[model samples]
Target chain A: MIEAIRECLGQEMDADSRVVVIGEDVGVLGGVFRATDGLQARFGKERVVDMPLAEGVIVGSGIGLAMSGLRPVIELQFLGFGHQAFHQIGQQVARLRYRSQGRHALPLVIRSPFGGGVRTPELHSDAFEAFYTHTPGLKVVAPATAYDAKGLLAAAMESDDPVLYLEPLKGYRLTKDEVPDERYTVPLGKLRVARAGTAVTLIAWSAAVNVAERAAEELSEQGISVEVLDLRSLNPLDIDGIAESVSKTGRVAILHEAPLTGGFGGELVATIQQECFYSLEAPIIRISAPDTPYPLGGVEDLYIPDVDRVVDEVAALAKASA
Target chain B: MSESRFLPNFESIAPFSRLTESGILDSGESPMSDEAVLEALRYMTLTRVFDDKATSMQRQGRFGTFSSVRGQEASVVGAASALDPAKDWIVPQYREFPALIRHGYPIENFALYFMGNPKGGTIPANVNMLPMQISLAAQIPQATGLAWGLKMQGSDGVAITFFGDGASSEGDFHESLNLAGIVKAPVIFFLQNNGWAISTPRENQTAARSFAERAIGYGVEGVIVDGNDLLAVHEVTARAVAKARAGDGPTLIESVTYRTGAHNTADDPTRYIDQQELEKWQQKDPVERIKNYLRSRGIWNETLEQEMLDSCAAQIDEAMEIARNTPLATSDALFDHVYAEPPQRMLDQKLDWANRNGGAR
Candidate 1:
């Protein structure tokens, strides 16, 4: 996964001189997870610049650079750290295009690692994709695999809108794919069916996608057909794909590591209920962590939804329907 | 913490002046030519006239609350005139109408902005200026990033951002200064220490002796100048612009000036400022001092003043007339410009709003 990101960045920077990478420790240290490893030596210090430990400046400056007709890919280290920069991200970066009546294009790409299960310290893991999804002018996208990561990065660069690209920390090293070396772009705002089935559909994104896939495999062993859909893009969500999947199955479960109260899962459930309400055979279940701050490493396992939790809930729905 | 161990007395970049308070030419070694001085005098007078007109218009219930750039004309005109507008950019933090005007942003747009129109904030494509930033200190970091891009693009362009004394306390200010120092970004941190950030006085804004002194901690050059002294402001700004273009790194310029009016039209200065202090600043009026200097040079008189004021007043009157004639903003304008392409949800909301507004859905 790290190699995939580095290759995409290299290709994009090689292809266009306008593309530059600026973030904390991205240049000399090759980023926290080495996602940008070797980019500095490959792209030079000027193109791959390391910034001070200031998140607002990182995002705000990215806005400035983008306004100056340069593409700045600002890395926020982690999603939780993005709080320090939420003002810039939510205010100037997102609102400039609209407020200026389309006179300026803040083509700033903000990429941050999110989701829990990595035993990270305080405020290191977060899944606040909804905060960005609710924003009007910005584009929000989350990729669950290396293939998607590379493609989306390429697509984000080619486009002119500001994209808040969320990368899962667990996927950085754990998730891998036979990603093609050459550059390719997977169009944004689309969902992928990771595992197809006919009985029930499990909708998930980021790390939740893997958990849903594992749950689907486990449920299949017990003769329960479960379809797993990867909701890669959260902002411009593919509501149609979700409606079709739920109509085929009649039951659905929305999953995310974020809290249950107002996560992206809630929006997906609402959309599904609205479009596929007649096809529903049972109430749509939303599985998520309790509405509480992410616990320390000692109790993280209890907070994150696992394969068993998903299977237990899915199996019960199937049993209730039968 | 030893004051003199690491450094000597913080050399005051003494404010340069060629004219006295009453307008006598105290120093003859002026940087500007005779014609340039006349031009500067004209701009300062026009800015003051526009400021008074805006305040009066607001009080007459024709527009919203407006920030008047009264005594800071020299700082505004000087900093703007020093830059190459075609290559340089101005990140305005509001209250820079004079600078924006010098950058080719029409004064009528500013007048329209106060009249509650979004199009009033639109700077033309030829003008290198951003929209008025009401959120304090946000433009600091943005300017740093802009300079970084300019350097990367191999352009000699520099980025200058204007802010108030109240903004110096914002975290964005320190963060941006540190980043600009580290990257040696070709940016200028222009602070118009206009005595007050609304009701909060400059003395309460920071513990540092001066806003310029705060720059030293960020590892950037700190220089102070008389914001009311036009030549001093222009000389320092021109030097900083050239230094940035030469890639010597960023400089923090503290334009020591005063906001001679209420913070905004909604404000009443009597609530916070002493009448005596207000009277003291009036003596240092930017336009009158420059006019006096030009008068001592046998170049300014009542006839010259009347002609310039008449022309400027007529121009402003025409702009106000145009604004009064323009139709009110459409409700649909709210939905437009939120994104390059409006999404399905926004489109639906726009339709609903239009229908509810006038059955235009």
Candidate 2:
């Protein structure tokens, strides 16, 4: 996924001179994750800038750049660090176009990696997509596959509105697939059905999709057929797509790495029930982490919902409905 | 260990000025032409009239809550008058109607904005200015980015942003200055030290002697000017704009002034204000000082003052009438401008809202 992102950024910058990348260590350092590797050398220091270690300025200045006819892609080192810049991202970037009444178009992308798997420090693996998804003007997208990462990033850069592109930290190097050499865009606000079944449906996004796919395979071996839906876009949620799947399966389990209370899973549950109320044969289950801060590395595996948890929860829902 | 010994020695920055409180030309010859002075006087007078009308309208339930730019008219108008609207951009805070008016934003838009219309923020394409930022110091880095973007596009236009003393404490201010200094961005940080941030005084806002001195830490040129003196504010701003256009990097100009009125219609200055200080600042009223200077030059008289007052009053009355007659934004308008293309969910929600409200799609 990292290599795919780097390639997509190179292609976008090559196609548009107005496309600029600004962040901390995005220039000579090639970014902490190397997602912007060799960009500064190929595009020069002017296009790929290394901003100071200030998150507020990074996004705030990007707003100004976008206003001046430049498409700015901001690379936040981690999603946790974005709290320092929520004022810029939520208040300014998301509201500029709406506040200006279409006078100013802020075509900018704020990219960040999140979710726990690797033994990162505290606050490094936090998943806070719910906050951005709640913002009205922003389009929140979390790509669960390499092909989707590149394609969705291309689509995000081309978008006239602000996009929050969240890359799963666990999938950056672990998630792999065959990506086309030429450029291709995956349209946002759509869900991809990773697996097909009939008895139960598993709704997930980002790194949670991997867990759902694995759980589906295990469930199939047990004769409890499962359907896995990878929600690529969270804000402009594919409600119609979700409703179609839920009506087909009649049983559902929403999963995420965020805390249980007030997580995006709650919103999904509410939406699903409203859309698929008569079709639902069993109650929708939410498989999520506890409502606690992201703990230290040693016990994080216990904190994140694994495949067993998804399999167990879905199997119970399937049996109860049957 | 003595903490005093560890403290670094710093040179004190003196406030730059060209006009005295009595409107005397103190610093050699004036850089302003006779026509320019009259124009500045006219805008300053108009700002005062607008402020007074807005406050009155708010009290009479004819307008929404508004911030009064009563005593700091010279600081807002003088700095804005220095820009070439064709190329330069103005990024202003909320209390800058005078500057926005000088920069070609229609006076009626101000009425519409305070009346809670989103169309009020819709600046004309020809006007190189951002909408009024209500958030403190949030526009500083954006202004720097604008200047940086201009430089990258090979345009020589400079970007100037207005902020208050309270905003000087925000992290965006420090980060923007540090970034603009290193990149040599063509921008100006116009800090209006208007003595109070609601109830907090300037002394409590910062422990440093002057806000301008902090510029040294960022490796940028910093200067202070008597914000009440229109000549001083204009000279300093023009010089900074020239330097920025010449690729010399950003400058931080701290314009020292006072907000003699309440912070806004919701505020009552009588609660926390000192009578002695208010009386002293009233003596240095910017509009009165400029009028005195114009009168001393035989360029202003009773007839000219009456004409300016009548013209300003008529303009305000017409703008308010138009604002009152302008139709309120429809429910569908809320769903627009969020994105280039509305999503299916949004379209569905819009349809649902229209169905419930019995309105057209």
Candidate 3:
């Protein structure tokens, strides 16, 4: 997925002089995660900027470049590290267009690896999509597959508003699929129905999307039909898609790796209740990590909402619906 | 009119002034043209009128709270007038009522923003001013970067950022200066030393006896001026801006003045400092001094004075009417512009809210 993103950026930069990538350890060092490897050598140091150790500066500079007709894709090493730059992201980049009444549009893509699975340590694997979700002027996108990543990233880079592109850590290296090196943009407000079923619907995104997929496959073996929906975009949710799936399934198990309280699941549950109320045979269920600061990666196995937990929730929903 | 002096150094780091308190031109000075004087007076008057209108509207619950620039107009207008509006950029702190106006922010913008409308100062791209930075001195680095960008693009433009004396204590102030020096960005760091940072006086803010001297540490030219005297400010700023546009690095100008009113209407200055100092600073009021000078020159007559006051008051009244009639911000608006396409969570929240409330009421 990271390679696909790198290819997308390289292709995009090749066509436009206005596009630039900036972040800590993005130059010569490539990136700590090597997400931006080989690009520095391809595009000189000026365009592939190696920013100072100030995330706020990185976000702020991205805003400036975007405003002056430049498409700046910023790399925040980890989602947890974004707290330092939240002001620029939340206040300046996100709010610039709305606050300016469309006079200024910050076309910036902030890419950061998120979620927990592999043992990376504290502050390195937090699933903080909700923090940006709460902010008014940011589009949050979490892609599970390489195809969605390249397509959505291409879209995010070109969008008129600021985008918070969360690259889940578990999927960065582990998830690989054939991603075509072409200029294509997947619309930001669409959801991908990864698997189809009728009895129950499992909705998730990022690494949790994979968990939901595995859970659906396992549930199918148990003679229970399950639908797994990958929410490509977190902000402009595909209401029609969610409504159609939930109405067909008659039950739901919303899953995410983010902490349970006030996470994206709470919104999904309410959305399903409102839109597919008459079709629902059972209450909507949410399977998520416990409501606590995401634990260290060493203990994160206990924190991430895994395949078995998702399967169990879907099974419970299927039984209840029956 | 000899090309204004560049990086002039005096033995002391105190206030620099070419004009006296009486408005008498010192030696080596020729009287300004009638048109230039009127232009200066017009920009300053507009600033004063704008500030008065904004503060009054905020008090009346029209706009959000504002940082008042009542006594600091000279520093704002003086430096703003020094720049070529087409080729220079102005990065303002919140209290730049006059500077924004000078840089072509429509009078209606004040009403739009101060009247609690989201449209308040929705800055246009063609306009060289940035939306006022509410955080103290945060715009300094941005101005530096902007100047660097302009330099790289080979545009003959200089960027000037305005902040209060207290802002000089912030680390961002130092970092921006260092970067500008290293890159040789054509920028100016203008500080309005209003003697207090929301009740914390200059004495408590920094130990560097003079904020202007801080420029020396960063390898940029620094000058201190009597912020009350508009002429001294204009002359010094004109010189600094010229050097900057000429590819010389940035300059720092500290305008030593006092904030006569509370920091905001919420503040009570009477509780903190000496009433005597306030009264003394009031005697050196920039507007009063300029008006006195104009009256003495016979350029401002009783009729013109009365007409100007009436016109300013009438304008404020009309602005108030517009603000009063403006509708409040809506809820879907919260979901509207965060991004070009809001994520699923945001869409869901808005839809759920619409379902509960029967549409964003």
Interface RMSD of each: 1.2, 1.0, 2.7
TM-score of each: 0.96, 0.98, 0.87
Candidate 1, B1-361: lDDT as tens digits:
6455765365545655555677665545776777877777777877778888887888789888889888898888878878888899999988888788888888888888889998786778888888889889988899999988888888999999999889989999999999999989999999999999888899898867788888888889988888888877888888999999999999999998888888998988888998888889888987777777787778878998899999888988888898888887777878777766556767777889988888773
Candidate 2, A141-219: lDDT as tens digits: 9999999999999999999989999999999999999899899899999999999989988999999999999999999
Task: Name the candidate that leads on TM-score.
Answer: 2
Residue-by-residue lDDT tens digits, candidate 1, A223-276 = 999989998887677777888899999999888899999888888878888898
Q: Once superposed on the true structure, which residue ranges of model 1 sit more than 4 Å away at CA? A: A319-322, B1-14, B359-361
Judge candidate 3 at residue B239 and give its lDDT. 87
For candidate 3, what is the DockQ-based docking class?
Answer: acceptable
Candidate 3 lDDT, tens digit per residue, B1-361?
5775755443556598755676655675633455565667666676667667777767777666666777877777778878887878888787777677777766567667755566665676678877778766667767876776676667778888999888878766876777677667788899899999988988998877688888887788888999988778888888888888788888989999899878976788888978999988888888777777677667887787678777776866776676666666566655555556555566777888766765654
Candidate 2 residue A40 Cα shift, in angstroms, is 0.7
Q: What DockQ does every candidate get?
A: 0.73, 0.79, 0.30
Superposed by TM-score, candidate 1 places the C-alpha of residue A240 at a distance from the truth, in angstroms, of 1.6
Model 2 / residue A157 / CA error / Å: 0.4
For model 2, the docking class works out as: medium
Chain A of candidate 1 gets a TM-score of 0.98
lDDT of 3 by residue, A1-322 (tens): 8898888889889988778888889989888888889999999887787776767666765665565557789999888888877777777777767766677677789999988887887788888899887877778899999999999999888888788999978898888898876789889989998998888888889988888888888889999988889999987778899999988878888888888889889988887898889999988888988989878756788888778877777787788853
Candidates 2 and 3 compared by TM-score, better number = 2
